[model samples]
Target: MIGLIKNEFMKLLLRKKVLISSIVLGVLCILLCLLISVAYKFTTKEAQIESQQYIIEVFEEQLEEAETEEEKNLAQANLDEAKASLEIIKNTPSEDDPNWRINVEETINILKEQLNGLPNDSGEKEEIRKNLLEYQELLNKDIRPMSEMSPKGINMLGYLIAFLGSLFTAIIVIIISSDTVSSECTPPTLKMLLTRPVKRGKVLASKFITAFATSCIVIIGIEIIASVIMGLIFGFGDPAYPMVAGTDYKITTVNAMIGKEAIAVFNSSYLSTIFSVLLKSLLLQVLYIMAATSFFLMISTLVKSSSASIAISIVLLVSINILKVIPYVKPVLPFLFMTYGNTTTVITGEIKISTLSSLPSPIFVVLIFLAWTIIPYIISHLNFTKKDILV
Candidate 1:
């Protein structure tokens, strides 16, 4: 059994499709870092000072145009605050200065307080407060200092993991595993394998396990390669920097999650422990990769053409993601495994889509994936076990 797994993995590694896709993914990571670096240059300290000056000008115009006593007073107060903020911006040493974040915290807190006083019935006010809360959480997070936010910093890893990493993992895993069984039917391969006396179930299980193991390896490898390349370019900063993980109202640090201390403290009080939260988030990502792989595998078994299997898988994924963006389709998101791809936000109970009223809990996410995971395998298994091979 171990030998079979090894052979399966070896065959996977030798596939030119896997090799080329991985290379493309790596190049994409490098290009993303370059793009981020260029963007950072544009948003530097000088640009910020210029922005503050513009805000002061806008405030002055508002004060001059005030229509009533109440409006005049508000405009005057805003003008004063903008002037003060300009002074602080002028005095700040650099873009990465810790004082910048401190200044932001003060600004966000004041805005939050002001928004809290507004009528709750106003949708615009609620949205502003929500935005302010997210900003406040970022300011309060004990992660890397502002100085380390460059493209080369460890901070980029967080962004990479959350976005690019997730994307590449899904695409590469889907592409590689999509053809696992389907491609075998095209030539002499399927008959050759079944003629060896292996049970159909075991054969299918080996393929599934092989694909899953390959997914893990590919994801981990991407992380390692990204870290090394980015570290070489930007110099690796502190590894122990805290990653803020929670909604603005309640938050915990990455340090707490690693030691599992956050879990014990927040379990009864919060939805789940930090450890459970992160673990579930990671598990969801893994499940997503597996689910994508199996979906494609099932497609392969049903379609018999690897190209058709890949095309159908891509179309399904893209279509679901498109539907996820449409407001009316939000109710179906909970049932769709594709919507759970952003596991970190899901685990934190912060659904990114504004139209969605509530996010699923960790338990619900697990149940959704469990059904998805089982159904695909059953479809592929039944087809593979019963299908006639004429070649």
Candidate 2:
């Protein structure tokens, strides 16, 4: 079995498609890093001041258009808070100044004041309250805020994993796996291999193992290359930056000025460092790749033409993602492995589909991925072993 798997791996490595894919992936990593570096340069302290100014303008307009006494009060409060924040930004000596802690405390006080002004049932109240709590926690812990545009390698990696990694990995894995079985059938490779006294089941198993292993290697290799390039461009950055975990929202009745009203209460309790979250995300990504590979293999087994297999697999993967945002289909999203494809979001408790009554536990989502891996392989196994490939 080991020898057969090795042989399959060797064949996969020798393929021109594999070589081309690797080059393309590497180039993509370089391009993405360059793009992020450029974006980081634009997020300067002055840009932040400009953003605050824009917010102040928006609030001023809202205050002007307010018709009711309550609306006017809310808009005035918001305008005042925006101006205060803008003043703080203007007065700060530098982005890295130690006075940031003091500024954050001041911001917390401003948010608390805004929160108090908001009516009990107002949706904005909950948002302000959440920010208030987050700021308070940061001040209490004395942890510096990690800017999204920090130009750090680890931050870049996090952004890539969250935004681009999953989609790229899925497309590459689908292309490779979808061709694994069906491509063999076209070149008399299946007949040639079966004549070597190997059981059909062993042949299929070897192909499955090789595809899964190759996809994993390619994904991890690309990540490493991207990380190294980013690190070289921008320092590796601190691994101890705090990441919020176990964030969730619940709908509950709150006592309003008029009466009780249902509102969504947002909460996040656990905190893990960036390194820890990245580690967990990487592990989850591997599981997702396994499930994706197995599912595509099943498609390859079912479809006789390699091109058709690839097309069908890509369409199915894309369609599943599209379905995720459809309100009518959201109820079934928890049962789909694609819902957990963005492992970073899953780890950081950032999955916020409003249609989901509650988020699935991580363990449960892991089981869903495992089921996808095992069930599809079983289907492929049964079909491949029983079917006639010599025709």
Candidate 3:
């Protein structure tokens, strides 16, 4: 088994497709770094204050146009929140400020005032409360809050891997897995291997293992290369920078002026360091890759034509994202293997308002991924073992 796996790995490494995929990933990493750098400049403290001023003006106009008492109250609430946030931004000290802790305390006080004015069960109130706690915690720890758009090396890496890396990795993995079996069927390679007294099951298992292992390597290699390049350009940032993870989405009824309304609230449950969050995201991504590879490999085995296999896999991948937006698909969305492809969102508990009710627990998602990996492999193994080879 080990020898067969080694041989498969050798064959994979010799393919030009693997080299092209690696180059594509490396180029994307560079492009993302440039994009983040530009974004950071546009999101400076001064820029934020200017933007907030414009927002305040917009809200003031809305308040003037309010025709009903409820409209007036809603506009007032929004205006107040926006004003308070502007105050917080203004009061925020520069990095070199010695009395930054005092500024944070003042920000916390402002958030508390905003919290008190909001309705007791309002979603905005809950969000304000969460910010209050985070601010208070920062004060207690004597740590300065990092800007969301900070382009520190480690920060960019985390952002890239969480948001962009997983999707691209999946694309490459799908391309590779879709061709794994069908590509060989067109040539005499598969036929020649079958005549070597090896069980068809062992041969299929070797292929699966090789494809999975290669995908894992690709993921880790891209990250490592990205980190090195980013670190050289931007300093390897603070690993101890605070991060929030393990968020949970819950639908709650909030007291509104006219009637009770339901809102989706995402609560942060776990707090850790940036490094820790990145590690957790990568681990989840590996599991996602396993499920993806197995599922696509099954398609490759089922279709004897490589083009057909790749085309079908690409369509299925695109359909998953499209189906997720259809309201009727919500009931089964959580169970679908592709729904959890964004490991960053899954780990951070960031769900769209439309799909809040469909949030699946981390354990449940793991189970679904496992089911995908095992079941698809089983079906593929059965077919590969029994089917006649035309090669």
- Top candidate (TM-score): 3
Point out the worst 10-residue segment of candidate 3 by lDDT: 257-266
Candidate 3 residues 207-256, lDDT tens each? 88999989888876777677777778766776776666665555643546
C-alpha positional error of residue 48 in candidate 1 after TM-score superposition, expressed in Å: 1.5
- Candidate 2 local lDDT, 102-149, one digit each (tens): 777777778888987878656567667655665666666676665676
Candidate achieving higher lDDT, 1 or 3? 3
Off by over 4 Å in 2: 50-85, 91-95, 108-143, 251-268, 354-357, 388-391
What's the alpha carbon RMSD for model 3? 5.8
lDDT accuracy of residue 89 in candidate 2: 75
Ranking of models by TM-score: 3, 2, 1
Error of 1 at 344 (Å): 2.5
Better of 2 and 3 by TM-score: 3
Which parts of model 1 are misplaced by more than 4 Å?
A: 50-95, 98-153, 165-167, 235-281, 352-359, 388-391
Residue 230 of candidate 1: its Cα lDDT?
74
